[model samples]
Target chain A: MTDGLPMRVTATGLPARVRIHEVGARDGLQNEKSVVPTEVKAEFIHRLAGAGLTTVEATSFVHPKWVPQLADAEALFPMLRDLGGEAHLPVLVPNARGLDRALALGARRIAVFGSATETFANRNLNRTVDESLAMFEPVVARARQDEVHVRGYLSMCFGDPWEGAVPVSQVVRVAKALVELGCDELSLGDTIGVATPGHVLALLTALNEAGVPTSAIGVHFHDTYGQALSNTLAALQHGVTTVDASAGGLGGCPYAKSATGNLATEDLVWMLDGLGIETGVDLGRLTATSAWMAERLGRPSPSRTVRALSHKES
Target chain B: MTDGLPMRVTATGLPARVRIHEVGARDGLQNEKSVVPTEVKAEFIHRLAGAGLTTVEATSFVHPKWVPQLADAEALFPMLRDLGGEAHLPVLVPNARGLDRALALGARRIAVFGSATETFANRNLNRTVDESLAMFEPVVARARQDEVHVRGYLSMCFGDPWEGAVPVSQVVRVAKALVELGCDELSLGDTIGVATPGHVLALLTALNEAGVPTSAIGVHFHDTYGQALSNTLAALQHGVTTVDASAGGLGGCPYAKSATGNLATEDLVWMLDGLGIETGVDLGRLTATSAWMAERLGRPSPSRTVRALSHKES
Candidate 1:
């Protein structure tokens, strides 16, 4: 209660420790209306690492025209070079050209975003699902040959805005394809945030049956319907070790102002900390870092933990 | 994706149906800054019942000086008389005087609010925990003699603002006392919203071990830290079938504007609907009701499902 921490009470059938893949810098910022300066973005990543997040997503190497918010990825990546010793800085690469730019800058880990649904794949990447997967094949192969770790992000794994509920078989096929692409890990994304516990477990079970081990899986849930933490709990119960969350619940849907985006890192930490699952992050410090970023964004944080803790501090 | 419904995938070991105790009119409106008109309050309760909420808490018979928001409880209670056939309109009775006021108005069901922590008992009721329990003893005795259903609410069961991490034994003792007071049901409240899934399960398990059946208990979770749904899921897994929620996530902490209040009914429905659990409520209709209430309150609803679904409707 002193630092807004929950009482630690471990649950059964959960992972002993979870690796938090912090995505506030890249995934969180990409959807922002205003572009953040390069220096501030670097500082945000550093603060996240300082708060004990071992894996901090840095920036995207996509064309600036597509995502102007992260156009300073080249300049920002250098400022984060010192943090390599403290955390894993993974940048997003869209294709072979993006991978070339990232490798030129000595990026050691990278992620390629794919979609489980054709509608989302076509809308987000301007290609069919198979076409997008084919495009990522070469990028993933080159990254593997360079000995760089590759994380494949499968978006819209649960429901699509245009396509309704995506079939589990469709998701399993796409997930297996990503695994076969030599990716070190696959992060299943509930892009529209409509997933629930049973659906989450069903998807994980299907992916496992399709030869994708739970150890190779991660979960990225949006809190759009306030189901992110519950879904995360389901995935953790299924033996998932990696969980992706944004610091301070940073992202908002570009189309819907009231719609929330990724699950807040502080909220996730509260649950993990209460479950007595080690994530190595200092919650108080992480909350402070989020408060600082919220100030720069000139808006209040969407995270309930961040709001509650910062309100207490004030 | 249509109407913001999640994919229905039934989870194992969960109850087939959950009865939501809608508290927007009583618990939610009590915390608002401005008092809503009595007619609007009546319409809100009627709309909740129309949306298939079988148990809608109407209003509190507490001293108006303490909660001026519900000062027109006498007027509001009469307007809800016609809803008796559609829903259980349980009013809150603080003491013998409140019980008298409610019974005179033909109320058939009532609830008495207590606290698991001594500090909250002293501050809220201006008496020791035992003193408050003694006060409710006669009121509950009279109600039971009159054949009126009674519910006892035990607040701060998980964590307290003044006393952190309340002992499970302490909550169990208080809960048992309430049940012994002839109350038909007991609601365990996470007053500060600091509870997590493990703590939730632990408390439920302890209460059962203390001879309190899961069917006789309900969970009232605040979304102050965004743990409500996950905590509710844990309770459901423990076989708890009753959940307390506010329409449109009403009620903000009076002391902290940014802190959320009770768990939103829409958010709860989204999860239950996705889990293939029956709640007998029409989600689309329920969301519309919340949106209407938010307009009356002059603010956006805090419920993620309401926001997501209403945004699409517009």
Candidate 2:
């Protein structure tokens, strides 16, 4: 133990650090058929943060009539403070009422949803695409007055199931609008799971040409067509830094019928780790958490990395 | 009809072509439970060509103890000519003896297997790395003298199951060796299917750095980890145009325990057609072919694209 070889154990860690925003508590629950207990959701966030996630989206304060699964958002966010303050838990707010509920729950960081395609906006939010943006303007302004950091979501960025393909111009328009509304960052969502690497390159390149900084862009991809990680790498190649991943691969847009699952956080971290990108996560722990949640959901963990590593390895 | 409308009608009238390379007769049959009858193999290839695969691989001519499934290679390849030359059948030849059998069967083209890693070479070919390559040199020379085109195969381009990670140096070394050995084209196989888009880029870049031309490198991927199509896109990005796909997702490497299936040709063609890549394939007909093969295999086809379009759309 006293030899120089033993003394020279410290090595420089991973080169580039990729920040993972865990969306399980919110995005995962949004698609659940079972009415998840609010206590379970709060406990889920606690376990996620304890497992080393810095940012976990806590809940969405939407109307109870529509998404009954997360209708108890009012009680969830306040209970998060009792859990701990180490993790920054964000809530999804749609309008002033939703924002008021989030603020009442003592939410500091929050996210709002927007759609690029007009057809999707009309079908989902009962408004045109521009009307949806206009609605979020005051919500962003109100959040700014409260000094809350807001993340804006631009869904149907890749393709809409109903509308077929959403144009990149629509994506650029929606993204620029969200940024102008004083949102801290914009996350693009491929609502339908029909995206490939080529579509990712074209969309991200168009966004870059539209003057949106890559650092301010976050990617929320579904592994439905099995191209999420590839799209993530394409965005990374175009300089996108922040990525959103669902823990245990628990993800599906509420409006999407076959919205299989999001990019697994475990797989993304695995790829990034192999590429020398430091994702400040314990993969072994993360895989365990995902497995536990999947068991709770009565389904196998959808993350291929989790299955491979957990089954065939230490 | 107006002149413009007539032009559109004519475009629709012309049959949509698809280069259906039937790997099942070789790639699929190589991993079956029972040794198929040689006439059954011919009938399968005939049915496949009738279903519209112009190119099909009939049998493998390896030593009997090595690959007992294709021990009837001498009987199988010759019987394929009785399919009335409807299918352009190619056979696998491990050495000159196999080549002699193939030439006796009048094989115009032959596929030679190589490995990008020494570990795979030992497992797959039963020889030390260079010894395997040295083994193929005279075999290729003999094919050249007979004016037979050799399609070289490099397995485990991304990784090998025995060895955790394959060095890019090994991939370039083997690819360059095959091309230099007079193989007309190369199809790099993701043997264990752990490849991601980044790994594909790294391997392709290494091949390019080693002065291997992109036009000759076709990707042969397995959907084991659900990364095949994304990896295919990475190859296309770097100008490696050709890709190898199995119909009805009929093949998985027997040595790879976790591999789900090969990349489905119908699915790949859907993405390629969407991206406007001229793969000379018909999507609808390919779906029918996949279904017919799936019925014969007594299993559900492994293509989601076909299932979705057929059940949902039709």
Candidate 3:
């Protein structure tokens, strides 16, 4: 239970309520070394939504050749259709083909992936930034026509493994293009987790100046460099309401060797709970869900909240 | 290298410079599972100073029966006496006996420990809060008479394991007593690592209002709940300049089973480096020193910055 202290430190500019876009079932399991069973994935999603997460990234509708881990997306999405009627079950769509497959499965929400740096775009997507944007243009247009909600993921927004620190202007350019092309929301991602709070402020300011409103933005940070929570806090102070996190600390950057995973949803909830920021998520249930998943993964969850909560329970 | 953008967002009230009091050699190794050899401990301290940390907490002079890991304090203090001329090598002295032990070796800087919760003080030090404060009175007084600098550590300032959430008024009372007893600096410690940024702001505000100058206050946080850096950021934004961090994220909490060690120096340096706030800590060298220590500990350094930097080098 939170003490219900003064929630908004008005001078600090932190938000009153934060939207946590849970990415465990999609972005998290997709990076696992082993393929999670379709039933296990569905159960994981069910448990997440049961924990009061309003938005859970369900699966990726990508080509199986590219990501074998998420090859069960077609099966996964259909099985999760009955859970959490109001929950946003956004699936990652690489192109028009992926979008079509997601639509075929009756997915109402989908996401397109883009990258800020040319090197990451070329290597990860086998296309230049312009080519990648071109590929997503048709998918976004069709999604808009279908009256489906679409989220755009801009990766390498902070730094590229090969190109080093990316300029704020470059991230802004990609973010603007995604929004212009018809994304309902854009999730700026630090794929390598080299971001700090100041960098988050700089990039967000640049994006805001470029005319992409902060209301349409969410932050996705990896915990690879342990800057994710601080970066998320900065985004909150910057008035960005939505944040992307994974349950049980489930994913790692496939691009950055030895990198950790996304910011843990439980850890994020701990901070939000302490700040008295409304997230509509149950910390106890979330911790239990992560603990269950961690037992299945045969390792301890890296989420500090999950670890602490589980220890308390034990 | 920082991009050198506007370092201080004037409205945020963050300090232009932060003083990092390195606590790895003392707080860190004291909780280590294995006893570090005296020469290795000296090298660790030397390497920390070489990494540009000007205030490395060297060792503790507590009774060996209480903290057997720091039994070699006499040998360690003399060994590191000539390493860094400008660095303040502060040692932790529990009472007059420990103070006499440290003073015998010409220790110039020493710290006295106190607790905000009566339960922790009684359990950890075998004295109630008032009794502990009474015990430290003569010690702090004698240290002041010797013209040696003294720091007071107020543990459980936010929460205690036995007592759920510590009253802010209780923490302020203990803090005021320590300052009135002639402590040169007071380090407010989140012993259980349960503090969030909001809690940090509330506690700091209460302390400031109770006549403890923000300038004389330092924050010591553990990453048990992964809230250390975020809490530290909040403290910075609230105008506190001094922070305590451990190298390689060494030292698990002997009390809190699930708690990690102190906030890692490398991680703190990474954030400061990005914020363009001056800490004078060499990120690369700090990472290297942690890596070296982690080798001796038979594990990889838990500091995310250390892991990321070492991976980059490899």
Model 3 residue runs over 4 Å out of place are A1-12, B1-12
Highest lDDT among the candidates is held by which one?
1
For each candidate, the alpha-carbon lDDT, in order, equals 0.90, 0.74, 0.86
C-alpha RMSD over true interface residues, model 1: 2.0
**Model 1 misses residue B116 by how many Å?**
0.7
| Candidate 2: pairs in clash | B17-B280, B18-B280, B18-B281
Per-residue lDDT tens digits of candidate 3, residues A103-209? 99999989998999998898889999999999999999999999999999999888777777788888888898999999999999988887888888888888889
Candidate ranking (lDDT, best to worst): 1, 3, 2
Q: Could you tell which candidate, 1 or 3, scores higher by TM-score?
A: 1
Which candidate has the top score in DockQ? 1
Candidate 3 on B1-314: residue-level lDDT in tens? 22231122222456889999999989898887678899999999999999999999999999997788899998888888786486899999998999999999999899998989988898888999999999999999999999999999999888777777787889999999999999999999998788888888988998889999899999999888788999998999899999999999988667554556689998887787778788888877888899999999899887877887787678
User: Local error of candidate 3 at B231, Å?
Assistant: 0.5
lDDT of 1 by residue, B61-129 (tens): 999999999899998898887887889999999999999999999999999999998988888898899
TM-score of candidate 3 versus the correct structure, residues matched by position: 0.96
DockQ of 3: 0.46
Per-candidate TM equals 0.98, 0.84, 0.96
Per-candidate DockQ values are: 0.66, 0.15, 0.46
Candidate 1, residue B19: the lDDT equals 96
Q: Write the per-residue lDDT of candidate 1 for residues A98-151, one digit (tens) a residue.
A: 999999999999999999998778878999999999999999999999999999
